[model samples]
Target: MDNLLDFFKAYDISLSQMIIVAIIFFVTIAMELSIRLFFRRYEKATQHSHTIKILFYLSLNKPLQLATMVIGFYFMAMHVLTWFRFTSFFDQVVTPGVELGLALCFFVLMNTFLSRLKTYSITKKTRTDGGYNNFAKIEQIHKLGQALTIAVMVFVIAAILGLKVAQGVAYLGGGLAIIALVFKDTISSVFGGLIIYLDSPYAVGDWIYTIDGTIQGTVEKISWRLTHIRTFDKRLIFTPNNLLITQAVVNASRMSNRRILQYIGLRYDDFDKFEAIQKDIYTYLGEHPDIDQNCLTLVNVVNGSTDMGSTTEGFFGGSSLNFQVYTFTKVTNWLKFQAIQDKIMMDIGRIIYRHDAEIAFTTMTLDISSEGAEPSPQAT
Candidate 1:
């Protein structure tokens, strides 16, 4: 050790400074390894927990390692420069650089911490009952938190660089004004997204349609400027958020039940069976498991004549007797509702057959009098 110090001393390098640097380097590596091992154990222990899974996804190991290295480098530089008698150089360049690096490390740590916290909040909320009902509000808060984190980071960086916060904000405000002017539509879309986030009209995975019937699809994602929709035909659409704000959208996924409306007609010959069949159909719907009995259900005869300007009772030009059936099904899923409706219709057909009644169809009957006197001869 004495010979090694003598060799470095001849080159004006202090062996003690070199030893300090070596210690810092090894200590930094040790800290990094310790953090890595700790996180690995934590991940294994909490693997089954979703909250822990999210935390693992947003782990602080990387930032913590970076910060440890930065701190170690700062100390090593300070010791080496002091031993070299470069006090002015250390004060002017090294000190400020170290401060800047430390500030940046702090910013990164804060950003990561904020992100982790926000993600945890959202994940926790999603696991609760009726969580979807407040998802939009939580999402909005998350976005706001991110923006604030970025703003605070910028302020800290500026302060480290000896910039006044008020001056920096003023410059930022002016720059933003110009940017807003240059990108008015984009800004509008951003505001539109904010409105959507706050209003909670429709959310991700909702089946929605425009009132004009032009756009109908399931919402896949909602970003700052656009909303992604997957159409029923398997096409993806990127629609501007502002456009959605201007239009009326129907959220089909929010419907409590699906409606079933039909008009059933019976042949006039089966008039005697009409009253019993109608009553039976109503009773079936009221008692069906798939039907929502709380909603409006109706099975009533058409009281007016089918012909225009006629006042006949349940007679459509004496061809058939018609009745309307209106009801609601408990299921709102498209495929499930269709299946239920099909079963109900088939059951109604069976009921009609059991009552000895036939569904009506258009038919014609003709009679010719002898006044024409043009009877064809028998086959000759």
Candidate 2:
């Protein structure tokens, strides 16, 4: 061992080099840690959230750290500055620079994404007063951002691997196209989700009823594959985004309340009680405290569209005398709507019965005789 030490000494492996290497070793560890510590200090000193503070500082310092690590290699190699030129300086930055950039980028992305996720988790619970369309859009935003980040990662990796940008894109373009075509439903769903998002449509918790005999329900979730809704019947419905985007949608929770315009037809024979019946119905709805008074609330004659084939227009004739009431109730929930409706209907039945009004129905009378037709009491 003594002889080996003498040999190393005689070979002119200077003690200075040993001391320098040692210093570099310690400093390298310090460099890695102190950089983190310094950022942490500033991050902790502020009123901002720890995550946000780190995020803000990271954005400014990531590239700077890469530059510093390149500088550290000089001290680590124990090389003299007179020999190292700009070309050598760049060379040192290359290996470490590539690694540092990707690491920093990924960290920033993850941290920011997590911060947004946390913010979403907390704030989404706050009453947006906006319908499920807006809420669904919130989730969609995060998902789209994640997808974009993933794509960026793919591009960056290809770039780092010395692949040309165009070549990388070309290599995947056809595959992506075929994949998109295969999963065309999913791609269409994203577009539909975006339509709902950008157009201020429904969110993930609104009670809605569609025209296609679909009843009202609470929107449960909006995903890339489907938008789920929980019906008041405790049933779950998965609607394709394409159906929602292209078809008609009614957002019941859009306003602070709901406006219900309904019709009740009475037989023309009981027309004598029309005035009194209208007054009673109007008074009851007016006195209801849960109804919004700010909107129009009086019953009036509403003309249907001019199309004779239309149900509304058809209802206009035959002495139907449709009385349209424009009123809004404070409740938008399905249960509350039903409860209010039941109360109103019960009251209406009582009033209609008291006035001896016959509610109209589609009935046909057949007359039968020996040769012709006459009504038969037995059939009744």
Candidate 3:
């Protein structure tokens, strides 16, 4: 022990300081292990309450362990630096860097905790007002916190290094316009994202259409700069957030029911049974399980497309009487509603067939008279 003391003394580390550092190292390890064991026991003890267990896991365990280790190391280094009288270099370089690193770690942990808490809370609530993810608001707050952290770190570092902050501020002021100009698009997009998050225009998994119908798809993701859309044809498009803000968007996902409107044409011969057909079809629509009972359901004859005063072109060749069917489905799902619609149409066709009626067809006929015709020379 005497020889070891002499060796350390010669190397400028007194035996007492060496012992203190060794003790700190071992104590840090012991503290970390203790924290882990404590959390484990606490978890077992509080297993009946999931929320409490989650709170403990999220808030206390990791942060406490990290803080214990970091504080121990920081104080240990300070003690050594003080003993060695390395104040100049320590104050200028090491102190600021360590403080910045600690601040960053704290903010990162805080951001993670808040994010997890938000996710848990939102998931438990059964009601949704507009969008699927409520986390976007939380994400905005986290980003703002990180930005403030960075700004504080910059000021702290400058003060530690003895730089004149006022002069730096002046310089930044001079270049502010250029910076703003360079980042105008990016800044606009960021604000646009914030507006989108706050306004709840649309959310991921929602089907939206631009008012002009140029863009229509399900929202896949919303990022800082762009919103991704996955179209029905399996194509993916990235649209700027600002453009979405400026344009009008219609969210079909918000609709409570799907509307079905159709026109069915029958041959002129079936005109006599039109009254029966309309009544029967209207009754069927009212009885259909998938059709919304509370909404308006109509079955009546409208002027056919071939009506003299109308200009709408008929898919059926020229002249045919048409009946209109308008109803709303109870469900908004496309596939399920399509199945219901198919069955209804087939039933309508069956009704027409049962009445000895046929669907209209386009036909043409021609006739000629040969009373005064000339013969060709080759016929002689």
Candidate 4:
């Protein structure tokens, strides 16, 4: 040990400077790389093969290597200073120059990897279902992470290379009032995206019932700026995500299918014969390969009023069958739902007609005795 110290002194090294050199070699470089390599090998073994594996490793290795080089350079520089008795020069010369640049580079690299790690974690969480996500939400997150990483790297590297990012920040802050006035929607949208990810009220393919009377058929897509819903009628509705979050959303397809109800009214006079009429209708629907269950049907309990609780009869009145067919379509497919409904309607009409019962229609009877004075052609 004494000989090594004497030799370093012979080669121009002080005790404190020598200690820094050893620390940089063992701690900053050797130990750091050893730890990184250990994790790398372990990760490669356990993780499934992907085309991105090579690129990911290279990305990590580059920083690991660059860090090693940086520390090694400092060690060499320290040795020079110690040997030449230039310690004062080292402190005076390196701080504002080398140290700042080193620190900035480290910060940028560390931030980039941190961003990547977060992206990977979120991707894993999104794949909790293990089923393939056609929506590719996780993949999109990864892409966004990549973009942000590059942006941050560019920004920091620019400052390190002496482009004065702090000056830019100052100017930006000075003009923030103008920016806010001009880009209010843009700023709000960024915050809205954060809320979306945190709250996760609904995902793609969910059927959302808006409180404002608009029934969004399915979530076609969701972006940072907008949420798109495809209506049952094949129309697309683009809503700002911010506005959507503020509104009440009824998620029908959240872990389950939606329910649809239908009501049909038959003439009140169809009764007595209605009991037997319901028999075939119920049997067919019960045995139906598509109808959900035997829970779908009803007989005539016709209240003598409009079907929709209308107090006045306009051009319609009848002894209605008052059939309440309630069946859930097993699938969330709108087309399938409509097809099943059409079949049910057809069957109901055929059975009613086959039973020789008339579907009631509105009627008005005026006694001719009182109207004889003016039996107008319009009335006739």
Candidate 5:
């Protein structure tokens, strides 16, 4: 050690300066090794914390490296300036540069930490509660958290650089109009996203139908600007948030009960048994386990209503009879709802057969007279 000190002294370097350099070098190496060992043990002990581990390593490594380099550079400059010709440039320019680097490193570290914490909290909540797994809500929270972090980091960095906050605010105010004009759509989308997060018209995994019939699908994800949907045909659609805000969305998955409204027509010959058929169908629907008992279930013959008999006045002279079947299923699942509907339809067909009724169809009869004879009116 003495020999090394003497050798540096020959080059006009102080023993204390050389000692500090060596200490910093060895300390950096030790820190690197310590970091590796700790991470290895931590990963082995808690593999479930893989996300946290990856975040920690990502947020830690670069900042530490940059900090080490900045410190070394600062001390080296100070020591070298003491021996050589010194100038105020080191104190004025170089010192501020080092401080800026350190401040940047700190900002990066904190930003990364906040991002990781946001992710970790979201993941933890998802594991605890199914509702917390709402992708739209979680995505909104993450975006807000990241925006706040960036804003804070900006202020902190400005302070470190000795820039006046008031001046920056004034400049921002001056440019507000231009910024607003340039990002009008983005601003609208951000507010739209906020509204969606708060109102929660639908969540991820929900089956949605737009009132305009332009979109119908399952919501797969919701980001800041767009909502992603997967259609039944396996096609993907990305809808802007602003458009969702303005349009009416029907959340099929959110319905408490699915309704089946049907009209069955029978031939005029079976009109006598129509009443019994309606009663039987109503009884079947009432006894169905999957049918919602609380909701209205109606099975009625159509004849004298203003629109029913009035519309049939021109055709068949109101002789046709139609039965209306209306009921709500207890389940909201699409596939199960379809199955229930199929079963109910089959049951109705069987009931009609048992009642000795035949299904109705539009028909017309024509009469042919010898070529020159007067044509008779058609019967429909």
Candidate 6:
């Protein structure tokens, strides 16, 4: 050390100060290497652990290296300043620079911790039964944590730089109020997102449709201001969260069973077979494996006008004998329900055919009265 210092003494460098700077520089490098080595070993050892893999995604090695470098730079700067007889600059600039660097390190560390915590929460929830029920809530909390982390870091950096934190916060509050006024719709959508988190009306992957039938799709994502839905046609829709709150939504995915309701009409000539056909259809539904026997199942002759104003009085004025079939299928999947419904409909048709009945279609009969007919004037 003496020889190294003496070598520089020719330029009037202080031996003791030079030695201290050298020590600081070596120590910084050693600390950086140590951190790097430690993290490398830790990563290798825990590579197979799922939890560790997630939590350690944000490594602290770089931040620690920066912190060590900053400390070394501060000490070297102070010693050099003293040698130059400019010690007054230490308090004005060097100290604040060190403080900012350290604060930045801490900010990064907090962010990393928060990120790990969020990953752990999501992992834990996904592993448990019924975890998806609260997934929206967890996402909301994670978003809130990130916002808070940033806000806190800003305040800390302000304080470190000799700014009055309270005054700055007051100014920020006022600015936010102005922003809110200018962006009322945006703010409302954010609140709507919060409501969804609390109410959990629907989660990602739920098939939903509006009561008015204007929108029908599967929920892809829910963010602060918008919810993404992928329509059946493969188009993506970005709906403002506020709209979801105001409109009535039906979560089709939650239905216990899919309904099959139909009105089957038979030709008036088949009126004699109506009772037998209805009985046979009802019996078939009761024995079907895909139908939900526990639900209300009906196969009845329509004796009067239906609520939809369809008259079923074949002998009175109607053209055909009408009967209604109402039942539910055990499967709620749309494709599977269609298959079951098709099979049932074909079977019903065969049953009617066996009874010598034909499904009815609209018909008209033309009549010419001899007394009122003028002989087609001789073909002109």
Q: After superposition, how far is residue 353 of candidate 5 from its true place, in Å?
A: 4.3
Please state the error at residue 341 of candidate 6 in Å: 2.5
lDDT of 5 by residue, 1-380 (tens): 98976766767876687687777777766776676677567557766755765777756755776687777778777767666547587877778888888877886786677667666765666533112234556555666766786787778778767899999989988898788789998878877877888788887778888999899999987777888999999999998889898988888776778899876678888867877887888889989998889999988754444254336432123445676788898776667788989989998999899888877765555777688776567732
Task: Give the worst 10-residue stretch by lDDT in candidate 1.
Answer: 126-135
Residues 232-294, candidate 4: write the lDDT tens digits: 899999877777777788776553332545555567667666677767776766776665553
lDDT of 3 by residue, 1-380 (tens): 98976765665886687788889888988999999899889878865665824763655677677777777777677767866778786777667666656665565566556655555554664244332333445445545665676687678767756789999899888897687689988778877987887787777667888999888999888787898999999899998888899889998877888888877778877778878878888888888887888999988666435342344644333556676788998767677778888988899888888888877665445665667767769976
Task: Tell me each candidate's RMSD, in Å, in order.
Answer: 5.6, 10.1, 6.5, 12.5, 7.5, 7.1
| Candidate 3 ranges beyond 4 A from true positions | 1-7, 14-16, 29-62, 79-84, 87-98, 125-176, 212-214, 267-269, 302-321, 339-380
Ranking by lDDT: 6, 1, 5, 3, 2, 4
TM-score of each: 0.74, 0.49, 0.69, 0.48, 0.62, 0.61
| lDDT, each prediction | 0.78, 0.65, 0.74, 0.63, 0.75, 0.80
Count of clashing residue pairs in every prediction: 0, 10, 0, 7, 0, 0
The window of 10 residues in a row where model 5 has the poorest summed lDDT is 127-136
Lowest lDDT sum, 10 consecutive residues, model 2, at 77-86
TM-score of 2: 0.49
- Give me the candidate number with maximum TM-score: 1
Clashing pairs in 2: 132-202, 132-203, 133-201, 133-202, 133-203, 136-203, 367-373, 367-374, 368-373, 368-374
TM-score for predicted model 5 compared with the true structure: 0.62
Q: Answer with 4 or 6, whichever has the higher lDDT.
A: 6
Q: How high is the lDDT of residue 89 in model 3?
A: 68
lDDT of 6 at 325: 90
Pairs that collide, model 6: none
TM-score order, best first, reads 1, 3, 5, 6, 2, 4
